[model samples]
Target: MILFGRVRMLLLRTIAYLIDSFILFILVIAGFQSFLLITGLHPFIGRHLYSISGNELHIWLFASIIIPVYMYFVTMFNTRAQATLGMRAARLQINTTGRIGIGGAMLRALIMLVPWELTHIALSYPKPFWVAHHLQSPLLYIALSLTGIYWLLPLLNLHGKSIHDFITGTIIIRWHMPPTKKP
Candidate 1:
């Protein structure tokens, strides 16, 4: 049996996002471990290759690379693959709410994962360039500075929507489940 467009679309999007968050949580843990070893820093599991209180060079490098990379990875994969690990596991689809194609998903993903926000990633420490370039306003920061404005769109608009949602026509939702639908 078929469900309403709203029901199916909403559920699907939610499932997809949940799957994405769950899988990426693992990726964050596992990826960062590899990130530490490759960069020659010590994970908390060990004594020390060095700590943050030291030169903090690793801090900068990690910030410059890791944060944006994680965002890019999640968005790009979510868009291009047409499904993230969570989405796939939950058996949901994306762009269905927007009723868009895989191509549209990819385009939307790329736009949201702009490269500049990486600058503010360093600000996470507020102490040092140890893991990143200075929060010196890279290209993404400008967009992010504008994010407050965009975020307000969701609040201001009647339906709680954002500019990106308007632009990509994308949103999160829960996928429908099937019952017997028997007579």
Candidate 2:
């Protein structure tokens, strides 16, 4: 029974994450297009944007993904809902043992960004760098390991709390809405 419940929760969480990711992707694309148009570079946008490399690519990734993701998580986590759209859809809520102020939420968001930023760093390097390093990408290895640890910690905890939760003193739990009184 416990195992089944765990699996169900896992599936819900995965679906929620996918939905959130899709939303973010759409927002990023729209923002990118809008930027190009506003800057009068629409004509040079589409295919050329795909060929961006080096510092330009880094800037784009940081601006479009990192900052937006950080802000999204921080805002969602700190709100009355205490969950992102994904978590809410999955019937999950963030609960802190003690009061977690804006600083706590921001720290949690920053810690959550570690694996993502590390993976980006590993992948953003030039192809030649990987080849020269004999394909032994330390950053990639570390990022993957950390990602696994972050995810696996939830399974180890009875409350479904992850590493980020431990660090920030927050936990994710099933949300139950209060019943309304009949008028």
Candidate 3:
């Protein structure tokens, strides 16, 4: 029964993450479209921003995605509910051993994003000049391994805690909101 609960929690977490990722994807597309419109309207801004090397473009794109996602995680975790929209949808909450302040939330968010960002780097080919600077690229293997380990971590434990949760001394658990009082 305990193992089953853990498995269910892990599945819920996975679904929650997918939901959040989808939301972020939409937001990123909308943001880029907005930027394109602004740039199209003003050639000067477009010229300055658009004029970048291929490698630099990749970095900029990554930053654009990472920055927003990082901020979202940090903000959501630091909130009273300590859950993102997806987490809420999945009825999940963060249970922290200590006060998980802004700094802790930031660290947790960054750690959680590491495997994902690494996978992106590994998959994006023609190897951005900086990435392919080395004679041999071990990034793909590292990325795949890390991603698999991170994703499988919850299964190894009963509480469904992943690498980020362990690193930050936090746990993700099923939760429910209390009933509101009548006016």
Runs in model 2 deviating more than 4 A are 1-4, 30-53, 126-136
At residue 107, give the lDDT of candidate 1: 60
lDDT of 1 by residue, 15-97 (tens): 65556656655666567657877787844435443344422543644564556445644454455445556665666544444
Q: Which candidate model has the greater TM-score, 1 or 2? A: 2
Q: TM-scores of all models?
A: 0.46, 0.79, 0.80
Instruction: State, as a TM-score between 0 and 1, how close model 2 is to the true structure.
Output: 0.79
Candidate 2 per-residue lDDT over residues 74-132, each given as its tens digit = 88888887888989988887788755678888998899889998877676665323233
How accurate locally, in lDDT, is each candidate?
0.51, 0.74, 0.78
- Tell me how far candidate 1 lies from the true structure as C-alpha RMSD in angstroms: 7.6
> When superposed on Cα atoms, how far off is each prediction in RMSD?
7.6, 3.7, 4.3
What is candidate 1's TM-score against the reference? 0.46
Q: Rank by lDDT, highest first.
A: 3, 2, 1
Judging by lDDT against the true structure, name the best candidate: 3
Candidate rank order under TM-score = 3, 2, 1
Q: Decide which is better by TM-score, 1 or 3.
A: 3
